[model samples]
Target: MDSLTQFTLGAAVSALCLGKKLGPRKSALLGGILGTVPDLDVFLPFDNPVDAFVLHRGWTHSFFIHALATPVVGEILVRSIGALRESRARVWLTVFLCFTTHAIIDAMTVYGTRIFWPFDPDPVGVGSIFIIDPLYTVPLLIVVIWAFFSANWTSRFQSWLVAALIFSTSYMGLSIALQAHVENRAETIFADAGIDARNVFAIAGPFNTIVWKVIGQEDDRYHNLYISLFDEDDEQARVYTHPTRSDLTACLEGNDAFEKLRWFSRGYFGTALQGGKVVISDLRMGLTPSYVFRFAVAEYAAGNVRSIPPQAIEGQLTSLSDDLNWLADRFVGQPSVRAAEASGGEPYGTTETASCVERQTSG
Candidate 1:
């Protein structure tokens, strides 16, 4: 989730837990600061943009780290402010919950959190909600602001905050249930179309339930299917396949960086081949034509028209939306280790497919 959401959630939790003791203003301030702390990983240096983006939501988000570090953090915070001298255990408990809740909420978005760091390098993504879901954040923000101004600090204020949290959490649960429903509908659609695909993944787009993307794999190729959840049934699936190009496999295969990127992206990538080069974009970041990490691949060559190089293709691929629907679906559902096997309906293989592009212009 974004910083505002983090701050609000943190503030709300803080106000709920400590408002009675610290007063609403002080509790909200403390909660907001703690909530925003985990995301500080973004300031750390990295070898590249990809590394920076990939390594973010790491260590600081870990439950173990929170448990071990909260006491020290709490002591420093308490001493700096000269506030209530609450028990070290109680202070630490509040800090732990505030920090862990921040990470847990972040894990529910498309860009997930590495909450299980050291124990597991893989990101734990739920993909049930967008990083900036107004439906989830606005109500909380409104209540927190109202509490801040009114200074009532009454039970009604706390009750409202709790109710908002419950609503947001419930929405998260509903996203998972909706994902299952979308997947089943997609499978039936695929069967009717005579497409023998095994793996099927569905993800909801940010802020709305009307649009979704489903990715299904058949043989060595991955198919991108876009569906509208608002439709009466699964009658609106649009399918797309990767374009045949040597650069697709050449760029992605046997490349450790690309492999890690793919895993991190949960295979929701778009590729383009131009001037014999390839450019890959993770579709999870909306349908923008630019790579999230500006320097993930080589730059485009000037004035060259023929023999599209792998790098150029990769750049062009940024503009395409072949699997964007799937990316949206995956972002909402969080990528499961068993997703590939369950959706693919067979043993997963290590083979890579050619990147897809519309048969029109290279750009």
Candidate 2:
């Protein structure tokens, strides 16, 4: 999830764990910092973007790392803060909960965390909630602020914090249920269309129950599907067939960089050929036109045309449906026409918005 959500969750958990033992102010402060510790890997300098991408959310977010690191962190924190002389076990438990809570919250989103790292490197993404959901964060923030002002480790305060956590966690669970429903519906749609596919993944977008990006595997290629959960009657499903090496052999003939990017993106890519050069995008991160960094054959283009030219990649690619029929057909297994329509909707999956939020926060 986003930083604010993690921070608030950490603070809330910390406050509840240390209720009365260490005042609300101290608990929130410590918890907020500990909550953000897992994300510190982003600051590490890497030699290349690929290394950074793979290394990030690696060992730091692992369950084993949290188990070993939390006690040391808790011990240091207790000694420096000098508030909770609690046993090492108690401190370790608190720290573990705080860290695990952070990881669990992250796993709920599309950009999953490697919770069982060194054991499972593949991201465990639930795609139930958006990374930054105001609905989830605002209430938690309200309670944390209330706790900060009250500074009273009373039962009432604990109740508020616990309630907020329950509400958010419940919502997360509901989102997962909803995704399953959407996936079943999508399967029916494909079956009706006579398309053999498996391993369908559905993700709910931020602040809305209507939009989702569905990815499924068919034969040697992957299919990108956009569905609107709210509209169950629409017959317009935007489906894109991502080219496998067999599909791209003609296009990417002698291009090594493009091949490397394809490998980097794990075959989840979109390409735009302009001015005799190719611009590739990894759609797993949402569909901002500029989200694609441009690389060209050095010999063909004399002067620089901007790595990813602004003019070449126009509107944001998304799967938003204003019509109910399209939504209905997308879910519940109905036959829908497979044609590209001009959709002015925001792209279904990607962390560009989160990046914008991070940038704003950093600024």
Candidate 3:
């Protein structure tokens, strides 16, 4: 979720838990600050962007770490804030919930969150919702803002806060259900098309859950299928196939950046050789033509692969303006390409179907 959503959620939860004791303004401000504390890991230094990207939502987001640090944070707050001193248990509960809920809701997005940290570094990304969804955030933001400006924490204000929490939580649950339904439908579609895909997942597209992008992985390639909730039951999403280049991965066997990305994406990644540099793009994020994270982790020299420190690739969104237009049409159940025709590129990213090395050699 975006920072505003986190802030508002934290404020709402805090206000609900301790609004009467500390007053609405003070409790909301404290909770909002604490809510964003875990994400401070973003400021920590890393040798490479890939490490920074993959290691985010790491130890800071862990339940164990939160639990161990709760007493320390709670004690500090209880001692420093006179009002909280009288309500030790409530203060502790408020602190704990503020941290835990942040991590839990983050796990709902496609960007993975390592809530378990050291015990299980493997990211937990439900992919049920996009990072920013107005549908989910607006209600909570509205309620939290209302409480923040309220002169007193009245029963009506408290009731609205609780209602917002219930609505947002239910919306999260609904996203999970919608994801499952899309995945199941995608599996059936793949079977009908003889795709032989076993592992498949669905992610909400852009700002809405009505449009979904389903990716099904096979051995050498993966398929992307876009479907809309408003589409007719008989309407089938067109499948776009993209290569994974598992064979090229052997050359990068010992490369740290390569392995980290493979682990980070849970095997949904593709490789391309561009300008003699080996570029890897996380297939799970962005659409085909533009990915959020792309790194040149290795190079080709003298017909041999040479490992290089990961260098982050910048925007590949030459067709982003067009893609957004397509997304809007797709969101409403209208048939459209993922990328615009004027872009003259295949929807996912490129038109090339061959291995990276093959493309270079043939050229």
* Model 1 error, position 59 (Å): 1.4
Instruction: Provide the clash count, candidate 3.
Output: 4
Arranged by TM-score with the best first, the candidates are: 3, 1, 2
Q: What lDDT tens digits, residue by residue, belong to model 3 across residues 1-363?
A: 789988988888899898998888889988998899889998999888889989999899999999998999999999999988999899888899999899999999988999998898798999999999999999989987787787677898888888989999999999999999999989988888889996798999888899998889888777888888987763556777766655556678768888899999988887766666668888778876577888988776555566788889863655567777778887788887664223322333323333333222210
Please give the clash total of every predicted structure, in order. Answer: 32, 19, 4
Candidate no. 1 TM-score: 0.77
Each candidate structure's TM-score, on Cα atoms with residue i matched to residue i, is 0.77, 0.74, 0.92
Cα lDDT of model 2 by residue, 279-309, tens digit: 4555555533434333332121332222321
lDDT of each: 0.65, 0.63, 0.82
Model 3, residue 172: what's the lDDT?
93
What lDDT would candidate 1 get against the real structure? 0.65
How much lDDT does candidate 2 score?
0.63
The collision pairs in model 3 are 288-348, 288-349, 289-348, 289-349
Worst lDDT 10-window in candidate 2? 354-363
Query: Which one wins by lDDT: 1 or 3?
Result: 3
Local distance difference test, candidate 3: 0.82
